[model samples]
Target: MAFPILATLVVLIALATLVPLSRRTTWLVRDLDFPRLQIAAVALAVLVAQLSLLDLRDYETVILLAITLACLAYQAWWIIPYTRVFPNEVKAAVSGDRDERLRILTANVLAPNHNAEGLLALIREHRPDIFVTLESDAWRQRHLDTLEDEYCHAMKCPLDNLYGMHVYSKLPLEDTAIQFLVEDDIPSMHAMIVLESGRKVRMHFLHPAPPSPTEHEESTERDAELLVVARSVADLDTPVVVAGDLNDVAWSTTTRLFRKISGLLDPRIGRGMFNTFHAGIPLFRWPLDHLFHSKHFTLAHIQRLPAFGSDHFPMLVELAYDRRHGATQEGLEADAEDEALADEKIAAEPVSEADVHEPQA
Candidate 1:
């Protein structure tokens, strides 16, 4: 009993602190940073579980194993919008007056994946009015044009590399604009969209690359881009919808801060963790794709799509905000320590004087 509980704590601690200890890796799987850490965490956990079987029928050992599994669940699914230990990231309080009811889908079609026909088929089948794609190329641009009639309003920033981005929509776009908010060549799209019901939402689409020595060197720029957006949403007078690959899990400190800052509702809460990445492999799959909305909009449906030649499986969300009660909130969910930590995280993000510019007209 004591041994298993003790071992479980050790494993949870490892998972929690893996990022800070292993500065070399940020992502846990694929050819990325978190791969080794995730593997080690799982391997160590399995060893702990097997070691406990030494005393079969031991109720305490069984209980400890269950508890250990529970901890793993919490780490992966729950702990995000409420981290308390690390307060070094930027955070802003959620604010807004009206909820914008609209449905949107964001996906990252790996540039190298040639079988994009399936993805297009899925898009046509689901028929989301608003679609955002990351890691796109020219071939993708031509193939995706099939929706040009359906989505008359569109923005395309195609590149030969993985940074290509595109946004297509049927909604009336106001102030539709694209900018490289952080790094040049890597673009993000932001625009005002009005739904058929007269509801207007400030939609921001982001797909910033994650932090690793080989990537952007550190999360400074990533944190800054998110903080800038978070602050923008926090200051908004209307409901907002920000979505994309994010490159970070929906439950990461940064994402949580974005939710808190934007006052958005994660449909996944109380719902299952919809792992979106690693569709090519089973053992390494997790939810990297996400959809979050203002409280006014209720989730009509949210699901992970089948693989379409990309490592990430796209997510589709149907939202309706014509609620009887208006927008409800999750409240100021973070503690002062974590809140301050978030403040620091945002503050410490690297910002250049040239980075600040007036929003494009």
Candidate 2:
């Protein structure tokens, strides 16, 4: 009885290992990408228990061992890029003109959370040049309005839906627009920010819906919106920065493709995971809030801030634009096949607002 039960468990774990590798955008398959680390850990534990307790007399036991080992290797391949073992894509910010520096703070305030004081305190201490909030409804916007004195330039879309986003900046904003790329209600911010040195940097802030039971059942819409944005930034010859709660993990296939298509560099790569979501549960966290930038900038500072009663912890990053370094930095390149994949997602009909459900305020 024990052997049969354990074999069934092993088979289920092995099946889960293949889900994330599939290119399908179904929720179950895409959600598998979030727990690669946890899955690997569990696989290792199961392998040890099986070797010690189960007899290796049967071919079935040997096959189980082989499958577990293969799963661990596959997961490690996907995760290795985010660890220190890999080389950093964005170089460290070196001594240069300090006026070109841009500090950004992005947080998903978890709309229902009322702990604005804690987030406000962090903003007062850091005083980032640009501040962005995700899942921001009218209530969260009212609480965040206190910082308007310091951040005079503001753009906000206060909706009851969790997709609401707002941006507050101390720098001058030029040619700003609130675009609804895929869905009408889901808004994204697009603008150019003038630095202290009079140089303009293009910036975009987005918070797409995640694949979940209550909201989106599949990742098609999320993938489409991101790929569309990625295409716009792919070859732009200016300093650019994209940040917000992307609602996706750093290691997912879609994210990897986005990095390739946009030619953006991830500061977190080879630095740290900087996992921001699931702040209440240490065991179920992944990197959801992201800050990706063009090669024109070098990283000065990047760190995950403490949780302030939201489901996501805030991310603070400081970057400096240097044209000399930009010429030398290399970005991921997408081949013909990559382009085709992106086009397919973009062409798919966008998920309607009616298909989504708003969380109760």
Candidate 3:
């Protein structure tokens, strides 16, 4: 039993390494995340099994332990993105004015998560200039009314299900538009605001449903919504900021392509990775919560705020759009090819458009 279990451990360890070579293994992408945690369980089971192997010699056991140590190192590789030590290319964009600060807080109050006091408490403490909430219902809206006085500018849409979104900002909003990019009723807000110092900034708040067995079919709608926004970001002359629960990991193919195409910078690199979602357990943490900005702003600080009775941990980011005094640098990457993917027509799947035009939902 001990020898068999040792061999099984070796095989499982080897299988996990192939996650990076996902072209050959189809389920690897889906299961790679699962095995990320199970490795320790595998290690413990192997240890228990090996210890009971009477026939194994001491030297042989030592060799097995060495292999286990190597597997441990492999298990830690996923943490690279989570730790946010990405290279210069992925580093945070610099700013000319270091003193400027813009605070943003993004929270997803799980529609059923009835802990309104905790969320209200966080709002009272943070006092962020820009605030966004996901999965908001009519009840959540009522609970958030207390915030109206602080961040009086409001564009809110509350729904029964979890895709509802809202945004509140202190900056002077010029042209605020709530758009239904893919389907109707699931609205996303787009606004242009001028800072007190006359710096104009574009802000977008989105909460698109993820593609899963129950929620959405193919990723066409999600992909299209993101790509359209990416295209808009590319055309902007001034600073642009897109923050939301994209429902895709930062390292996924779509996400990398989004960053490259949008000409945006992630504050995660060189800074710490504040993994949000699954606040119930930290082991399953991923940076599903995010804040991406254009070259004009420098991220002063970013963090995943404490859980606010939701599955997704809220992300709070402080951004200042003033450029720093550095010799202007270039060589920025632009997604010239991503446009085709954005504009390409999707197979318009049959969706329940029951409330095609829901009454100001």
Candidate 4:
């Protein structure tokens, strides 16, 4: 009985590990990409059980062990890059002007959650130069309105839908625009932020729909939205920061493609998982809220803040715009193959400009 159960577990684990390797965008297939760490752990546990308790001398047992080992290795290949065992993709800030520093906090407020004060308390304590809230309806927006006096530069697109987004910043925000990239109801914020040092930085805050049964049937729209943004920023010469609840894990194939196309560096690499989603679930959590920046900046600090009545915990990241260190740090460059894939993704789900909203300055 134990041998049969272990063999079944090993086969299941191996299937989950291999299924995501396909280019399929269906939610059922893509969802497996989220649990690489958990899958790896289970694979290791099964391997141990087989070695100590199972009859490994049997050819069937040996094959099962081999499959489990291969699954574990495959999962580790994807999970290891986020661990300290891998090299840090974004260099730590050594020396930079204080005025050049930009602190940002992003949270997915879980539209139904009414704990606005709890989130407000976090903002007061951290006092991030910029703060973004996703799933913010009119109620959440009104409660957070008190922040406007300090966060004078603001962009709000409050809606009843779960995709609503808002960005408030102390830094001067110019040319702000709220655009719906893939879906008309889903909103993404874009703007030019003027740092205290008078340096301008292009910023994009996104909260694309996730590939889930309740949200999206397939990952096509989500992938297209992300790749569209990636291509838009790929050739930029100035500093850039793209932050929000991207609804995709940092290590997923789509996200890896996004990095390659955008030439952005993930701060979480080599630091920690900093898992921000499933805030209430200790065992089933992954980093969903992400912040990626161009090589024109280096990481000063990155932290996963405590949850405030939301499924996703907030993320705070302080970045220093120092061209000296930024020049030294290398960013991922996309090849012709990557460009072609991105073009196909964008073309799959064409975006309409009819839903774009530009607030009056």
Candidate 5:
């Protein structure tokens, strides 16, 4: 009885670990990418159970143990880079130049959540230079509007469709545009921010649809949106920061490809996972909200803010625009194969005409 039960568990773990290795865009395959850490934990437990109960003399037991060990190793390979065991990909900031520093806060305020006051209190306390909200509707917009006096530059796109976004910035904004990259209903924001030192920094906020039974059938649209943005920034020479709820994990194949293609540095690489989603479920959380920036900027601080009636906690990051350290830090370079994969993913999902909304002066 114990052998059969353990064997079934081992096979299931092996399947979950192997299926995500494929390049399938379907939800069933891609969604498996979210729980690598959880899967690794289960594999470890199963391996221990086999060692305790299963006979080493049997070949079947040996094979099951080998499969469990392989799954553990595979999952750890993808998760270790984000742990302290690995070196930092993005260098830490050395300079204390307040003029060159920029602080950003991004949150997904779950459209149905009515605890606007809770989220508002966090913004008031943190006072981020720029703050963005996803799944913002007219009700959330009205409540957030009270902060306009402090955050003078703002862009609001309120909708009940669960993809609406609003960005409020204390810094001056230029060429701010709201664009629908893939699906017409899903919106992403692009803008140039004028730092205190008068240097210009480009910013992008994205909240692509997730691959789930309720949201999307597959991750093709989400991957396409991410890659399209990655291609846009691949050749740029200026400082860039991309943030928001990507609806994907930091270590997922699509996101890894996005980083390789865009040459953006992830602050969480050596710091921590800083899982933001499913705030209610501590054990089942992965990083869904991400902030990726150019090498021109170094991380000052990154943290996950407390939840405010939403499934996701807000992510706050302070970056110092120091070109001195930028040359020392190298972003992940995309190979020819990466380029081909990106092109293929982008081509799989055709984009519709975008509705561009510019901020009112």
Candidate 6:
């Protein structure tokens, strides 16, 4: 009875591992990508237990163990980049140039979370040049409005639909637009901020809908939005920074594709999994918020700040934009297949002028 039960569990784990590899965008399939770490840990434990206790007398037991091992390897390959084992994708700035450094702090304050004081404290301590908030409604906007005294140049889209976003920057923001790339309710902020050195770097703040019970039924819209933005910035020469609650895991196929298509570098790669979501439950947390930048930038400091009564802990990243290292940092190149998939995803949902707008200055 124990052998049969163990075999069944191994088979189930293998199936879960295989589900994420499927191209299906359904919530059931997409949600599997979020818990890759947890799944890998459980699979590893099962494999060790089977080897230690079970006798491999039968061919069935041998095949089951083989499949389990393969599943663990697959998960590890996807996760290894976020661990310390892999080489760093964004190298640290060898020269400390204050004029070239820009610190960005991004947070997704749960709409109902009223811990404004906690978040305010983090902002004061970090004192980022640019700060972003997602799921920020009119209420949260009121609290965040106090930041205007410090961040003179700002863009606000305080909607009550839970997709609202606000960007506060001490630096000068230019050509700022609030665009809805796919769904009408979902909003993304696009702007060009002139740094202290008088260099203009484009910034994109996005909070795409996640594949969940109450949110999106499939990841089609979210995937399309990211791919559209990826395609737009693939050829840009200036520094680019895309940050916010992406609503997708760092290791997901969609995000990996986005990185390749956009030619962006992930600071989290080879550093650590700065898991931001599910602050209440440590075991279930994964990195849903992200900061991906162009090859022109190098890492200075990146950290996950303490929770502030929200489901997500804020993420702060300081990047040094040096044009000299533009060619040095290698980005994931998109091949023919990656380009084709990006096109398909973008064509699935196209944005128009009606979906784009500039905030009231």
Q: Between prediction 3 and prediction 4, which has the larger TM-score? A: 4
Q: Return the lDDT, model 1, position 138.
A: 91
**Tens digit of per-residue lDDT, candidate 4, span 80-180:** 98899988989999866889999999999998899999999999999999999999999999988998899888999999988888899999998888887
Per-residue C-alpha lDDT of model 5 across residues 219-239, encoded as one tens digit per residue: 999998888888777757788
Candidate 2: the clashing residue pairs are none
How far does residue 308 in candidate 2 sit from its true spot (Å)? 0.6
TM-score of 3: 0.76
Model 1 bad stretches (over 4 Å): 1-52, 55-101, 323-326, 331-339, 349-361
All-Cα superposition RMSD per candidate: 7.0, 4.8, 6.1, 2.3, 2.3, 2.3
Between the candidate structures 1 and 2, which one is better when assessed by TM-score? 2
- What is candidate 3's lDDT per residue for 1-361, written digit by digit as tens? 5665687676677666556445221233433543353564566556556666635567777777667656666655544544545443233435545335578899878889999999888878887877888888889889888788877888888888787887877766667788787878677787876666766778877766666667665555665566667766674666778888887666554566677667777777645657686789866766677788876665566767788678988778887664552113221365446545434522233322231211110
* 1 or 5, greater by TM-score: 5
Clashes of each: 18, 0, 6, 0, 0, 0
Estimate the lDDT of model 4: 0.88
TM-score against truth, every candidate? 0.76, 0.93, 0.76, 0.96, 0.96, 0.96
Which portions of model 6 show Cα errors greater than 4 Å?
352-361
Candidate 5 deviant stretches above 4 angstroms: 352-361
Alpha carbon deviation, residue 149, candidate 3 (Å): 1.6
The global Cα lDDT (0 to 1) of model 1 is 0.66
**What are the Cα lDDT values of the candidates?**
0.66, 0.85, 0.66, 0.88, 0.90, 0.87
Candidate 5 lDDT for residue 329: 89
